[model samples]
Target: MTLRWLLTGRVQGVGFRPFVYRLAREHGIHGWVRNRSGQVEILGQGRTDRLDRFERALTDAAPPTAAPHIAEREVLAWQQLEDFRIETSQAGDRPWIQVPPDHFACPDCLAEVRDPTDRRYRYPFNNCTQCGPRYTLIRALPYDRPNTTLSGFVMCPACATEYRDPGDRRFHAEPIACPDCGPWLSYRPDTAPAPAAEGEAAVEAAAAALRAGEILAVKGIGGYHLMCAADNTDAIERLRARKPRPHKPLAVLFPDEVSLLRREVNCSEAELACLRSAQRPILLLPRTPAPSLPESLAPGLGELGVMLPCSPLHALLLQAAGGPLVATSGNLSGEPVLTDNAEADARLSDVVDGFLHHNRPIQRPADDSVLRPIAGAVRPLRLGRGSAPLELELETGVPEPLLAVGAHMKNTLALAWDRRLIVSPHIGDMGSRRSLEVFRQLVEDFQALHGVRATRLLCDAHPDYTTHRWARESGLPVTPVFHHHAHASALCGEHGIDEPCLIFTWDGTGYGADGGLWGGEALYGRPGHWRHLARLRPFRLPGGDRAGREPWRAAAALCWENGLDYTPPVTEPSLLRAAWQRGLNSPATSAAGRLFDAAASLIGLLQTASYEGQGPMLLEQAAAGCAGEALVLPLLTEAPPWQLDWTPLLAHLRDGRLPVAQRAADFHASLAGAIRDTARRTAADHAFTRVGLTGGVFQNRLLTELAQSRLQAAGFEVLLCRQLPCNDAGISAGQVYEHLGGQRGED
Candidate 1:
């Protein structure tokens, strides 16, 4: 009998073809296995029983890395052949197969690095088919060594032997290399005779630099990372100063599980599993009562971003140092992570003590992904490194390939082809030159890698956005989607819900249809046809852009709207008051985030924000200890943009006798109540049954849970973000969904 099989789902660059070849040889079948786009194609001829067993084993007992193996088999003409073998990969113009993202170092590679007797002992670039860089190294299709960064390093005779041997773990590994033939590391600022070192010596030198309370720029799988001992206050403070990032938490890479446990970082089984998984992202875990790290590391935040070593080099560095190290993106503030060695030396020379760079080139730069456990599931904050180029199966198809250029902040790109949506890794903010360059490269690379040309480009409606300008200039047909609408579309697309749903989109700011900044919108409809049903009442943002930096400005705006004669604690409050009164540079905005900031500032919990969401974070922290019913607030029904007036809530907050903690909790409850009331009223008016909560404001766990429970009690199915974030980072996905979900076409 003859059989032809097509296998999909993480089959490429994951040792699937080699596994198939081994299985064929074991069964004495004559067949060949090769990668076709994102899938594995196999043709085998043998006894009927043997073919059946091969089919069963292919799906059941494939390699550990070849996951979600979906197989389809067809009977074919029996072809007589002497032996089974692996065939050359067939390239296509469209991305129809799944490309496995970069994975953590496998156990075998780690063992080889730890074993002193092994030839690869302490080797920084030690990797195999089961693990190591895949997405970051691959420059083009076929996923062969010639198409990857490893093309520069020819394999040694011993490594060649392992590559050819199907039974070996490194069989057909694209990145197979050793100390004698692979890329070597070098120290920057060329001062000493032994500036460049190979194998164990290079690893030790980098580790020694970390031990001496100095920050080192270490080249990692996706990009460069700044490393320093987590316990060293001077090093942490210095790193913060160099980056000019004051309050945002830094991720800590612990040497081992014991070291992590000793720090008393709270972790559930699921979180620990994610930390140890192949996609080793920085897991944001709760901090213990007495956290071991310096307060400056994660000041004002309750959770600590922690991760285990994802690469053999990271493991070796942490092992040699014998302590936790602060691992942050190797870049200045608001810029993309540095991947090029020359760029690192040029940009990070003064910031880092020394550079630990390797000769192996990096095709693209990706930062470490950040994730948090919420309601017993992992949620992505920044999708990069091991979790990027994320593929989401779309229930609907598009007319042609589509590109969705995301928002200005937390920028990411997305591509829609056939019934799949591929969201690119997080590309940071689009404001910086480096970040814009990275975004352009990522878009072009995605096109080339997948062999798909985007005929249509979807962008945020904001006319001033860099991504929007890029789309307009691309020569492709452009579709401008509203910012919050994209957020709603992303969640709807993920759940495969094509029907109209109630979307409560809350965030800081989005370009609204009324020529004003809008957030905290309650819309009712589907992707392409959604219309805003109601929104928070517009209030003047005193000093315009300065309102985000100073929460007191938002407080002043709220106070002015409510006719309160109160002076806010701010620099030149009178100037801000004049701006609000004269409408000079004070833009009217209906934003839930501004409301949170106003409430926080009113209670004196937070007046200034060092980071993007700091005020809301502190407000949530203060509310953590208070337990009470939601305070009553007026839900005014005038028209179009209905008002959820904060007058009653502000009156309660004005009482100085009440504890700030209680006021914070009451404020959260009141806002949640307002959201629930608006959602319920909109759903009843539209006769909708499902409600989707999206946008950055939903990142607040307290508000999410509160709104979700209330909506459920009010008899509506709730759709909350699971795989993708609720922030602007997820806008690309929603954009793609909005672009394609409404269209019906054939490939």
Candidate 2:
């Protein structure tokens, strides 16, 4: 008897063919197996028992990350079979395709890189089928050598031999290259060390600059990174002073074990695993500060984000330069990450002391992903690293492929095909022309690479948002997803839940569908759909965004919301009075962010924020230990669409019975209670059970933890955003999810 089989699911890049060959040989099958598109097809002539054993072994004993192997069996017509072997195929195109993303360097490649005797030793571009470059270098799909950067440099005979051998790790590894054949590295700085040639000499000059306490633009696998020694106090301070990042934690990249001792912190098994993953994200670790590090790197922050070297260049630089280095994103705050070399040179001339950067084209820009451990698995704070290119797999699917332009701030676009969602790297605010270009390019790159043709687009409900503006100009069918609802919706879709769940979202600002600014809010709903259950009461955003920079205006707005008067609310001589002149500049907003700024000023927190979210973080730290007082919170709405009015809470602050910490704690409790009560009322009316929480506000540990507890206690299942961020960084996923789901009028 003869048989044919088709196997699918994560079959590419993974060692599917080699494993299959071994299984077929053991079972005495006579035919061939080969990959066509993403599916692997097999033709074998053998007894039914042998065929079954071969199939079972292939599926069950697959490699580490191999997903379930889906197979189809067919009774073949009479055919004479030769020896069973793996072969190549040309029919790789499928009308409906789900392409897998590129992956990290595999173990075999790593061994070759470290082995001094190996031809590829110390090759920065060393990669094989289980690892290395994917989408960034790919110009097209089916992802073969002819279609990649490897096309420029043909593989050496020795390497080509392994690539052609299905039994070897390099088999079909499209990116395989030896040092003699692959891309070369050359150094270019303003002042070059004497005789800057190729290889080790170029690396030595770059190391010299680092050891001298100078900032250098060092290029690597993904893109350029602004590097400076972590332990050099003066150098670290210089970077901080120039960058103007007063309190946000700087991500540290350790080159070797010797330097790990300098920044190593109190970490659990989960934390360690996250740091060591292929994505190699900056893991937030708690420690008593590195003795070698100065206080300037992260002023007044509780933790630091750290990682180890995953690239050969970074390793060599560190080995030469000597110790821990600050590997911050190569961009100014509120701007897109530096991608082009010319762009980096033009913008970073003053910030960087010198250049250790080389010329290796970065096809797609990706920032280092950030993660933190919550339950056993790591919760991605910012999903980048080895996680982009591939789409975020969904549980509840959409009807058509959709393109979602995420929030205006921390901009990232989402491209969805079927249930697969691919989110772009963090693109900063879309207000700038440069950032917008990066955003648009990211969208085009993802669609072209994945063959995802979007039929509809999803945009935030906020009409005035930059992202919304782009969506309108996109010339594609778009669905307007309310800012807060999208936040919760993304969370629901990420964690794989269907029913209504309590969603607690607290962020700086979002345009509520009610024509108000919303930040601090709690709601009960599911992914694609949500109801406005409760929110912070209306307050003025004095001078609009001007108030965000100067928190005193927000503090004054808090008093105004409570029916009080304060022309100057604060004692700062620099206070701009026109900002508080009612309609002269002020606009009423229900933004939770305004509330944080207001509370921070009231509780005597940081006078002003150098960057976004700085003031709020300080306020939360001060309000941490206090067991806050209970306050009378009125309903913004009488019933049904029950809203917890901020009037009573403001009056409590006015009464002055509670200290600032107690008042903040009480404010959180009031917000939690309001969400809990309203969700119960809505659940009773609609008979809904699942609730999803999304928004930058949920990033507040205290607020989310408390809100989930209160709602869970009330018999309402609460779903918190995990796979995606609660912040605007993860907004694209929600926008894509909704547009894909029939939420959009047109496909």
Candidate 3:
């Protein structure tokens, strides 16, 4: 008898080969196991009964992460003469395998780290085939040690022995290492070895302070994070005060299942399942009035971002604290998440009690990814950790190699090669010198490694943006990609939906094709083809950039633009009146995000935003309780490109008398409703089935759900972005979509 098997998806790097070797030897089956580029394949020959047992064990008792498929057909047995000898990893000649996302800690490795008797006991960097780092540490493909950050560390004799042993837990585990040989921890300032007693003590003290109502900044695998007990009202308030993160919901880390139920409110069985999944994202569950926690943890938000223990050290701290902790990106408001320990130590010194950190270097700064199990299964709210540096499926026919320079904010660069879209890790706003350097590095690295030559460059139409400026100077033919088009195209790529649908691109700032700041938009669009169909009624952005910080300026502008009776009260709302009375504000701007900001301000909620999208985010939070339509945004035929005018809609906001929450809800409902009606009309005219929604505004859960529901109800199979973000972080993907879906064809 003879047998063979095929493996796929993250099967490489994990110790599948050794397990197969041992299982084959034990069952007295003769076989050879080796890796193919993207998969593992095995061939075995033995007696029927023994092969059957071997096959069962391969699937049942294999490494927890190894997923294998067996194939058997009649073939002559290559009868074994003696014991099984380990085979070398073979090259996988085939080309279609995707590089897997870095794996989170596995249970077995965690068990060993916790077990005092285990050789890897207390090993902070403990990893095996079943689990460890993946996307964060990997630098190149074919997943060999030489291609990863681990390339520098050579395995010790003990680790090497286990690495090659058929019976050892780490056999064939590429990142396999013990404390003796793997990466070690050290402190930065001292440079001398900081023993656990001396080094980790400060971390313990910080945790203690957190438990006692103090915030601490802790450095993790990817970047720095601000931590404090979620249950401690003082700690939450302190973190908020220090960071100035007032309204946006802070992400919390739960110890286990018990704490998950205890804190967050609406936990459906599906959400719980996803929470426990290996992805380990910050799950968005409904908020609960929990005992022991402060309501201010999530501010005005209806739901919270929560995650279970991802690292062994995180587990220990949570256990010591005895509850959930507020874990948010460690950065001062607009800047990127800090990856350098020194930066965190210097900047967050006063903000936190002390730094709970180690010396293991972070190659890139990736933020904590947020996710929600909406419309079935899990979808990414923010694509990071376990999900970034994504490679898109490209059409191989593109005539020229193009570099899609993403937006100026939440920047990510895309290099398209022979239909493969290689996206860089999230680069923060490129306006800063540091972010600009990172962007340049990403372009160079991708071009060098992927062997892509820049024949043409594409960028946002924004002239002043660093991305656009760089693309212009790149000496490549530059095509200016419109902001809303890229936004819509990103959602189109996610679902591969190619036809025209209604696109609602509402964000803080985007250069409209009409030579104005266009955030509020409703367009009939596809990946490559989009026509401006409608937009929010135009108004001058009061104080220009100041409108973002103070939503009230736009709030007052909304009142003053259309005919309204008395001036707003001269109290807290007076700021808007003053901005209006003074000629400091603009009178002709059309931005959807500003509309949201204004709405939030109108309710006396988020008068000022601590961060980007903060005002609108709080508005969504406040509107959670307010559903059902209270007002309808009227459609008027006013401008070219846009078939409908928003002037009538502003008229309603000026006169409608509804409660703040109800007004907010009606605003969202009408926007989605209008989009649905417009999309129906657009699709009928365009004669297409696919409807794709993208952009920052689509990040709104309420708006997303409403638009999806209405579109489906209208006999359209609507596609929503799940894998990539609808926000600017995903704009690079959209840019590639435009490049690929462009008339030149091919990726």
lDDT (0-100) at residue 409 of candidate 2?
A: 87
The residue-by-residue lDDT of candidate 3 on 186-241, one tens digit each, is: 32222223333333354455566677776767777677888888877777777777
TM-score of each: 0.96, 0.89, 0.85
The candidate maximizing lDDT is 1
- In model 1, how large is the Cα lDDT of residue 431? 87
Model 1, residue pairs in steric clash: 38-97
Order the candidate numbers by lDDT, best to worst. 1, 3, 2
Clashes found in each candidate (C-alpha, N, C closer than 3 A) = 1, 23, 17
lDDT of 2 by residue, 646-727 (tens): 6666565444665767767776676667666667766666666665556765555666666678787887776665667668
Report the C-alpha displacement of residue 654, candidate 2, in angstroms: 8.5
lDDT for residue 458 in candidate 3, whole number 0-100: 83
Instruction: Point out the worst 10-residue segment of candidate 1 by lDDT.
Output: 188-197
Candidate with maximal TM-score = 1
Q: Write candidate 1's Cα lDDT for 551-615 as tens digits.
A: 98888888898889779676787876876799999899989999889888888877888788888
